[model samples]
Each structure stands twice: as C-alpha cells, then as structure tokens.
Target: MLKKITLIFISLAIILTSLEAGTSKRKGTAGAEELRIPVGSRGVALGGGVVAEANGVDALFWNPAGASFVNKSAEAMFSHVSFIADLKVNYLAVIANFGGVGVFGLSLKSLDFGQIPLTTVDAPDGTGETFSPNYLTAALSYSRRMTDRIYVGANFKLISERILRESAVGFAVDIGLQYRLESGLRFGAVMKNVGGNMRFDGPDLEWGVVIPGSEPGAPVRSLRVPLQEFELPAAFELGFAYNLKVGEAHSLTLAGSFQNNNFTLDEYKGGLEYSFNNMLFLRLGYSYVNEADYIFNSPSFGVGLNIPLGGTLEASVEYTYRKVKFFNNNQFLTVRVAM
Candidate 1:
C-alpha cells in the first residue's frame, strides 16, 4: 500500500509540475483570494510545511490524508488571527472519527474587515453609509487509512465573498495522500482549490443608466456590467517530515515542503519543532517565495502547550507569530480539545 501511494503521489507531483511549467504567475486572476491564507496556526507558524503528520481538525486544511492520525474519537478547534492592517480571521473546525467508517470533518474560516464608509462618484469623500466586506470558506472532509502505512482523503469547500450588495460564490476541492515508513519518515502530497471559475454579480452591479443614443425622450434602464470570470487559487504541494528523539521525553521534528502555485510563484518552506515531555513545544520556520510575489515572505515563530485531561482527553493552546516586510507582524492563537 505504501508503494502504491508513493507511486500515485509522485506521478501527481510530476504531472502538476509539468503542467505548471512556464506558466506565468497570474497574480490578480484568482477569485476567493482569501483561500490563500493559511488556516492552522501551527501550519502557518511552520511556514505551511505541514502536509505530513497533521492530525485531527488541523489535518483537514493541510493534508486531509493525515486525518487518519487522529487518536481521538472527536476533536474541536478554534483559531483566531490578527492579520495585517487590523483584519481579523476566525477559524473553527470539528472532526469525528468512527474507526472503519473513516474520519469526517467540518470547518469554517472567515475574514472580518471592519466597516468602511461608502463613497461614490457623486460623494467623493463619504456617502454617510457604511458596509463591511466578508469572505468565508466552509468545507467538509473525509479521510481513511488505506493500509497501516498509507492514508488518503479529500475535502470539498464552498467559498464566498461579499461586499455590500455584490458577492461571488464558488466551490473547490482538495485531495491528498500520505505515506509513512517504519523508520518514522513521512511523506505527503496535496492538490488544493481546484474548481470552476466565478464572477461577481449583484444588485450593486445593476443600476439605472442612461443610453448614449436613444429616442428624444427615453427612460433609464438598469444595465448590468459584465464581469470577467476568475479561476480559484490552485496549488500542488509536496512535503516530508521526520521526528527524532533526543532523550526519553524530548524530541525534534524537521519538515519541508515545496509548492507550485497557480496564482502566484513557486515556494519552498522549512520548519523545525522541539518538544519537551510531549507537552511543551517550540517551533520556528522560514519560507522562500519567488520575487515580487508577496509582502509577507519569511521567518515565523510559535509555542504551544498541551495538557492531558484524563485517559483519552486533552487540551492545547498554541500561538504563532509571522514577520512581514514593512507591516505589523501577524499573530495567531488557537485552542483545541480532543476526546
């Protein structure tokens, strides 16, 4: 099973890379752009090198295949992010594992941009109106172990973006495979945000307008402006992770990932995590992005604490910090409970 999974993921990686070769980065062509933002604090702090060994609700966003690693029958997580420019991101997820039936998960992520005063051609400054833009993603995921060493999973998501009376809706899917060797080395691959294009439409786009050439006396008709369709922010990712024991209760993890992004540039990331007694964790990561791709492009740090709540129950709190160029650094806090 491991061999088969390996062959499949490698083939997929090759195919995706080949197809993406020579394709210029279409920086502004993707819709539902919020999907590009990382969801899990740990993953973000790790510079998104978490395709392997992710467990519970977090796995659904990184590499669904890793969902098979969930040791709990049920798990729940809540995450909050203080993004650049005062934007806020909130994420919530729940996972249920039913042994042979597989693992099922539901997750929601949303970005909150504070209210902005309405302005129009007639009102240059403000129209005395306010509106808030909203971006959200809702997903359902399923994963199962194909064998002791192989796991596979997929996720379907509904993505929506709304600004005042204008909005766009689209759907996407994520597929992943994971394989682990007895030596504790793990591999993972995933294809994310593959879906049809979307275009904005709403009453805001249709309003009364005067015709240039019409009869002497003509009535104004609401004309709808056509908006070009845009594809989703798609990407293919490959990653590897390994854990090494330094002492009886001390361990270290090293992870790395490479990605071919459809809407931007290719990227590589590396991360390290140190654990003490399986309860306290310290993590650091770095990411390299192709030139002119983005503003936030580098080092991140994180810390986490896990506490046992009895036999099979536990709770954890994690925090991550990311440094950006010429902007305030990003901060994320996540809380998780498992049973």
Candidate 2:
C-alpha cells in the first residue's frame, strides 16, 4: 500500500510538470469548449472532485475505473443540465460488468441550441426560417481492476458539431487510474480530452466567384476559404478523498481535487458529503478558479435519494444547484438504476 501510494504521488508530480510545460505557451489555443462542461449531478455538486469517488454509470464522465465496481451486474443513468443562455445538456450512460474480467460502458452527451431565426444579407430579421445547432459526443469505455487496490480505465470519444451548413468532427480519449487504501482513503488521476486538431469544412466557406464581364450574370467559378485547425482543451486532474463512518448508519466524506487546464487557468476544489444509512445524502462544494483567463463556477449544493426496489434492483436520484459567473445558477438532475 505504501509503495502504491508513493507511485500515485510520483505520477501526479510528473503530470503536473508536464501540464505546466504544455500549457505555458498554448494559452487560449483550444477549441470545442462545450466538451469541458462537467456531466452528472453528483459530480457537479462535488465541484468536479469526482475522480476518486465516481461510481456506477456516473463514472463514465469522470473516471472509468470506478465503473468496474459499479453495482452487482448492470447500471444505467441519465442526466440533465440546465445551463446558461437557455441551453441544455443531456447525458445517458450504461455499464455492465463481465464477471471478474472487466466492465464496458457506453455514453452520449448532446447539446441543442433550440431554434434561431435564419437571416441573410438581403433579409436581416424577417427570414421566417429557423435552424437549430447541434453538438454531440459519444464514448465507449472499459475498465478493470489491475490489483487488489488498483484500478485503471480508458475512454474513446467521437465529437460532432454542426451549425447550418458548417460542421466539425473530431475524436478524443481519456485515461485514468484509481487507488484505494485499507483505511478508506482514495486517490485518483486522469488525463481528459487528449486529441489532435479539429478543423471545420462546409459549403458556408465556399463562395461563388464571377469575372467582371463574364456573361454579365453567370458565375464563372467558386472559391473556397481554408479553415484553420484548433487544438482540444486537454486537462489533467488529481483527486483525493477520505470518509468517516459511524457504525453503519451515518457517514461523512471529504474530498479535494486539482485541475490543470491547457486552455485556461488551473482550478482547485473542495467538497463534503453526509449520508444517512446510505439512503439520504447532502452535499456541498466550492471551486476556486485561477482567473488567469476567465472566471468559472463558484459553489454548489445538492441532495440525493437512494431507494431499494424489489427483485434485486436499486434506484438513485440526485439534484444539484451550481452558481455560475454571470449566469446566476444552473440546475442538474440525474437518475440511475442498478441491478
């Protein structure tokens, strides 16, 4: 256990140094900002200090390793986030364990921009047409226990974004590890959104070109503008947690996490949770943003209910309220089923 703990710290130190070096000159270079939003109500309530304690289908958003130990056989979850600008995000994930071998999970996150009036240079505001923008990310994940106290996992994601006639498609991956001690202490680390550049190409960038006197009405050819590529907003995080248990009825947990972002400033998080009989839970958390680039979410609070059903099934429902900068507050709802 001592050796494993030491290794986890050493790995974190290395990653921190690497992240500092990689983000030193790439300040504002990343795109696809929607991918940075945290999913799952429990995670948001903990201010994203979920790397170590992520469980069930919720782990699909944070650390895939936790999914390996999720439930007894199968788990499914759905999440809804009401964000700023009347935007909403929806997530769904399912995980199934394969005996003592491993666990496989699948999830999707989707964003919709509702409807916007379509206007052109000729028609400024009365186009009478509307279009909705779409953004989606689909992932496949797998996790396994490497040792009695160590777990590892990976996730591969496909991202697609479209607006009118323009679209961008890209891919990314996540790698994570989790370590648990006999003393109820946990440690976790992960690297998220590691991918290459994404460039958009569509008919919107193509323009018809015509000579000054070429047939006086017909266009001669078309000119296309090249789109520049942008890097992904990769991030690295380290998390730690410990809990105090009173017999079998009441428990309290405290967690802390550090995030290193390539496209923005680093962040720190602290969270606390109290559960009664593992059925009712109350959570609170705070996030400290570096403010080097911009401000981020501030504080969050949540409540959760876990109920056992007949026929070896259990259900959990969670709700969270997060305070965002300029956006007031955002609400999240999540539901999970395990069997």
Score each candidate by Cα lDDT: 0.87, 0.85
Give lDDT tens digits, candidate 2, residues 1-339. Answer: 768678777977796877753434666677788888888988889888978888667888888877775547999999998888889899999988996789999999998678989999999975999999889999999999777788888899999988888999999999888887778799888889999889888999988789677676685698899989988998888898897897889999888888888877777887899999999999998888755434455889999999899887999999999987776478999999999
lDDT, residue 69, candidate 2? 56
Q: Which stretches of candidate 1 lie over 4 Å from their true place?
A: 21-25, 213-216
Give the clash total for candidate 2: 0
Query: Per-residue lDDT tens digits of candidate 1, residues 1-339?
Result: 556676887798777767553234477767787888887778887888988867678898898888878778999999999887888999999999999889999999999999888999999899999989989899999999888888899999999898887889999999998888778799988989999999888887778877999887799988889889998888888899998989799999888998888877788888999999989999999888877546767799999999999999999999999998767898999999999
List the pairs of residues colliding in candidate 1: none
Best by TM-score: 1
Q: Best-fitting candidate, measured by lDDT?
A: 1
